[model samples]
Target: MIAHPNGTISTEVSDFLLNCLVRSSSWNFWLSLFLSFLFLLAMGANGVLLVTIWLEVSLHEPMYYLLSILSLLDIVVCLTVIPKVLAIFWFDFKSISFYACFLQMYIMNCFLAMESCTFMVMAYDRYVAICHPLRYPSVITDQFVAKAAVFILARNGILTVPIPILSSRLHYCGKNVIENCICASMSVSKLSCDDITINRLYQFAV
Candidate 1:
């Protein structure tokens, strides 16, 4: 581990092995199979929903657009974390490259935040539609959706970038086992050899 001038640490670990649940138990096989089925079901359902919205012009409204965004976010979050988890559980392939781990961490944090923002905007849409029915049309337009999309992207996209970057800068001497299905920010940071006060505080604030 090397200390930096900015009071951060850096490590040179090539990869990490995830400490998946039930690694040696007989139930691992059945759990992996069930998770695989759920993964496929989620992907298929989200894909069909997106395609249906695209094809049907009647459903081409702002609400459907937000739902589509939410679906897309869910698909991404699932894809980001599940395949590797299944590989770990089924084939014992738990080695994730250092950079890949950080990438996964970034995607999980950013997309989840974006999903939350989408829900908040959806709530606002419902409020306008129910509480102020007449002005809803003028208030919520295509332009408003476009702006909200931009806000979601810009807000969460920028805010979550630091998580992976900070984690990458930490020094890891030997402990490279992540005790979770996904490369969560706190889980990964706990393996660092340096102080993670900032990481913990930032995660809490987020």
Candidate 2:
């Protein structure tokens, strides 16, 4: 439910209309084509990398584990954002359901943070391998990678879960048009009929 300062609570949130350029414009047509090409390229590259990492026994090491995690994160991000963007651009279908928008927000936030954490872990793995070669075998083992996986999930899940929760509690009784191709947190929050300073600060701190 959305609470308003005037002692009114509403459960009638409307679907958010995503903003895109005029579908008839030649520029938009070219732009959409370009975006589609990039999306396909990215997906193909990441999918191949992920499959290779999964099937190759020689690549079953700590560094490759982190690499595969990065690939999965990339795939998740692409799948979450590209399809909706293409829908908006190609078919002029821009409305996104309320709960689905929040779900997208959560996935974007969580996976993005996970990618950064995975990169950090990868860096540490390389550091241990290069600086402490003899100890690398014992220090960065399969168990260490497993623990790092848990750490990434736990840390990002705790930090990112509140973004949608806090965003949903705000009153959005007016202007449901989201001035972006995707359900970006800022685009959605800006339409709420309430103060969003807390949301902004919390997202920035995260």
Misplaced by over 4 Å in model 1 are 1-12
lDDT of 1 by residue, 15-70 (tens): 88898767465788888889999999999999999999999999988989999999
lDDT of each: 0.90, 0.88
- How much RMSD separates candidate 1 from the native structure? 3.4
User: Compared with the true structure, what per-residue lDDT tens digits does model 2 show for residues 39-152?
Assistant: 999999998988998899999988888888898899999999989988888787889998999999999999999999998999999899899999999999999999999999
Q: Give the local distance difference test score of model 2.
A: 0.88
Best by lDDT: 1
- Worst lDDT 10-window in candidate 2: 20-29
- What ranges in model 2 sit over 4 Å off? 1-12, 21-24
Best by TM-score: 1
What is candidate 1's CA lDDT for residue 3? 74
List the lowest-lDDT window of 10 residues for candidate 1.
20-29
Q: For candidate 1, give the lDDT.
A: 0.90
